[model samples]
Target chain A: MTVIRAALLGFGTVGQGVYEAIKTHQKRLQERLGKKVEIAGVLIRDLRKQRSLPKHILVTDNIEDILAIDDLDIIFEAIVGNEPCYTYLNQAIEKGCHIITANKAMFAQFGTKLLEKAKQHRVQVGFEATTAGGVPIIRTIEQLLQVNKIEKVEAILNGTSNFILSEMRKNKLSFPDALQLAQERGYAEADPTNDIEGIDAFYKLMILSELIYGGQPEWRTVEKQGIRTLTSEKVQLAEQKQKRYKQIASLTKKDGKVLASVKPILVNKAHPLYHVEDVDNAIKLETSLIGTFTLQGPGAGKLPTASAMVEDFIYVLEKDKSIKQQGEVVYS
Target chain B: MTVIRAALLGFGTVGQGVYEAIKTHQKRLQERLGKKVEIAGVLIRDLRKQRSLPKHILVTDNIEDILAIDDLDIIFEAIVGNEPCYTYLNQAIEKGCHIITANKAMFAQFGTKLLEKAKQHRVQVGFEATTAGGVPIIRTIEQLLQVNKIEKVEAILNGTSNFILSEMRKNKLSFPDALQLAQERGYAEADPTNDIEGIDAFYKLMILSELIYGGQPEWRTVEKQGIRTLTSEKVQLAEQKQKRYKQIASLTKKDGKVLASVKPILVNKAHPLYHVEDVDNAIKLETSLIGTFTLQGPGAGKLPTASAMVEDFIYVLEKDKSIKQQGEVVYS
Candidate 1:
């Protein structure tokens, strides 16, 4: 069987999930691609740590080890930081390998540059997991842009913040208590600074803005206010009036300038974003053609994020096949 | 400039909308495809009728006039019926021209046959507008199927029936009164048999079923019940219980069999379809990888349907370009 050799840049939650998904759905992947997807190497922080990977696959702490793999077809990067992930992806692209990443922070900062490098190298870059996990918002936006102009985009891009706000409103709990519950459920990190301080949503919003408008607002000028100071009383009062408080990341182009913001807004019942609660994320796009289009699903998770990457991998393979073959293509 | 010669099979609402969309987005289309889209011919029922088309375009009552167009790359079919539309599409496919259609009734019956013929002729058939007009459910499903198995699909596929049901509950109107209001608002046709009797939703459901499962229930075996018999009192009672009556078309795979139905189902507030009101349509897909993903939008409108067809046309062009070009491809 023809095998596409791939490497993983991190063995964290998303990386492990991607590996497991490839294992569990190997048959389906083979059936769709007509080729086997093999994980040739994995780059981890600690080589001493035990992993349940097959013995034939190489696990290393050095990025150079994975980059040295012969005929490496793709790279899946799930590292948390912005420095090495960006540099590593550039290196992979230089080696003519398609790359898929879940590193939102790194992507938000250097996504446009990375895309240009990938373009110049004639390799694909899949970042669907960088914005909204499992919702396919990136792909949806691309398809919508083919025939329609997106006038406005309002979205709940951070699952942790949305979950915290929803818990506060639904359980009438204080912000701290709701955040504690979120941590207990693994929705929020130990520090929770990035998620609760609106920085996470800001990154995702910038990613979306760049995709839709082909540019983004100046980072410091983009207003971002998180939900740490919102009181339980305010949430309850809003609920009494049939309104809900949600963390909304919005982008609108006016006067040929893209205005972007990430803040907590009280939404009415008629608003599509009002019902989007808990760990679920939703995006409402007001387009030039379709009046209002909404898509909602799990914003972030091991499987959902991994599923996005796997789907991107399959898409890259299929698109690559179309360029190589002259006969009928099932999807194209 | 390189040009793609095209034709419109019907000049009804959807057909006219497609023409208008092409004209309005001509610049963007040319920018994306690097090819000007030219409407070389149009097949209409009345040859002498006034059409708001350019003088350079040919409008005809006969199909042969359209088939004779030189270098025809695509055909956009929006005709209402099953027989002549199917035959015309088959003929177009035989000419090795790509086709996009919004004819749900015809597609629900002969979609598989048409797809097979298109495959044989190496022509693409796009039926994105056949299921949920602006929701892009068909394309969403196709993308999801790449890495996930769809376990269940529940959707509001008809706007007229949903409008009547929403009005009946919201205004306490009788079924006939609500339907009359829908007709006045141009949401329903004068002959409301297909919409009110659930046949329209059934056809769309069948189309979705065929897309997902590659087969559908025997037509007679599918249980379909419309909202015509739903009483205002019942709707009010359900509303009091925080529920809504929606014309739901649902499909589930169990024990390796695909069970399908279209009916007026009372949905609780927690149900995704509960908040879908008026002419809005929503589809909830329960997939193996993504859990429950929902998309909501305008179910039917001139601009929305036309937007879908135009998007499909762009997709076909992009895919075809990838097959022909050996160098870099933007979307692929």
Candidate 2:
């Protein structure tokens, strides 16, 4: 592997983070992977948008500019939503380019479709950033599944909702005031329905369920509630009972069906999820043989999310190396 | 790709667990790896030892009996100590066999040598079972190093010592009484000095340091104090202060040098390591980008330790596939 080229699909916070990480850690990346990682193009909405990058690095307003690159190996999608990004990812998969996506909105809805397309084209997909920002929860679960059956998965999947709940609990703020604080803290967007209404956690839980069971993110099956329904009084009541309110996304088997729910749950001091405060996310995976495995870390941030994508990039490269090793003889 | 053969180096608890898991999950192994797994032999200490294995699987007291077989691809070493077993592992590595061990005594001391030997022989050395049983702590750290620089690692790496401490804290028992109860509960062995004296945790922390900073486990540099120095009064004092006593193995960089230590520390409810109770291990790695990442799970058990070996076996087999894939073109 001499030089592997990649395209950035969106110049959002995570995209800027990816650019910065690649720029700063270029030497370490090359040293670890034994290959040069070249960012061939950055796709954004506006050509007039200013970004401080090297003159050699290309910034394009059109995805076709990146698609025209003859030897492109990866397309790292950081765009939000499902329409254009989904279409772009589908096209990238059809063209046999591996994908590293940060956008869970599109992935949560069209994950099965994208996975099928990738399988058909024999390409790899990396979605570690879609759930928890930098934590290796998904990859860890994949490894655990090789030996143990994961009986239950409980997680704090949305940073915004958790931040809101924590603010409401600590500051004794009303729901509206907590939302304002979250927005002020830059943890919540102006149109924060996706997080406050539990849709974001729902999507993450759906992706988790998809990985565990298969063909999931069935919106109809998931019981959905969010921090919007919780009040300061309710938080105070839970606190009085030696409890804390955390917006939890849980997946458990009930009556032979994998049931998923995104809601605010009261947890006591004994629970691992009890102390996971503010924007930090935690996941507890209960296994048959290994008992309970819990992981807690920074869930969503620019560097953290980009770092997750980098991990995915390395994972895809690793898989590619393995596949190409076989390709040297058997495939050829 | 037809049939890969493995030899179990001990018929103890973990070895038997490995044998049972391999036997039961044969179908899964075949489907996952696209190959058949065959246990060639089990090397035991006694020829008169009775076992329930099939007649086709040979039980031998001599290492040469199993090593003589040319097709042995893997040697899962579940033996206790270094002496003869370490020599046998070295010989096996020299013979171009992959080594998976549950013994940490020699590994902590001779790991660098073994790693260099494995590299020289182009074979892998899998030691997942040596530390933290089945918790994928090592694998997680390996992934974290991909994107972030680890700053500090705080862990409860020993199960037997943790069990004893928890028993003392919960049952209000003395250290000796707790040890007796732990042994009665089968958590500690007859000669539990390795665990009680902090040597076991020291070995685990050393391995972790070696992975991150390199050139480690210089035994003299580590500050070792085990549960032997802990008193029931100290436990009571911690309880009075709403804290718990935990035997923590920590590795951190001070003035650009990695410092390692194993000692009893007091932790409050806010800390992740505080509540990690009986027979459970936890590792909290503080990093530059991802903040604090923690993993907790059942640390030691027959099935759990065996599951770790199984994980190592699969890891070695996966790497072997890649190596064989390349070998098909170059080596042939």
Which structure among the candidates has the greatest TM-score? 1
Q: Which stretches in model 1 have alpha-carbon errors above 4 Å?
A: A322-332, B323-332
Query: Model 1 lDDT vs. the true structure?
Result: 0.90
lDDT (tens digit, per residue) of candidate 2 on A1-332: 48989999998899999888887778878988888999988889978877787787778887788888878899999998887999899888888899999888888888878888997888999999999898888899888888777899999988888888888888899999989988898999999999898898888888898898774635886789867778799998998898998888999876777788888888997788887878888899988767787888888999889989998999998897788777767766
Q: Give the residue spans of candidate 2 off by over 4 A.
A: A254-256, B330-332
Clashing pairs in 2: none
Query: How many angstroms is the interface RMSD of candidate 2?
Result: 1.4
What would the per-residue lDDT of candidate 2 be over residues B116-176, giving only the tens digit for each residue? 9998899999988888998888788888888788999999999999988888888889999
The window of 10 residues in a row where model 2 chain B has the poorest summed lDDT is B212-221
Cα lDDT tens digits, model 1, A1-332, are: 39999999898889998999999999989998888989999999987888888899999999988999999999999998888788899999999999999888899899999999987887788999998898999999999999999999999999999999988988899999999999999999999999998999899999999999999899999999989889999999999999998999999999999999999998998899888878999999999988899999999888889999999999887766664443233234
Best by DockQ: 2
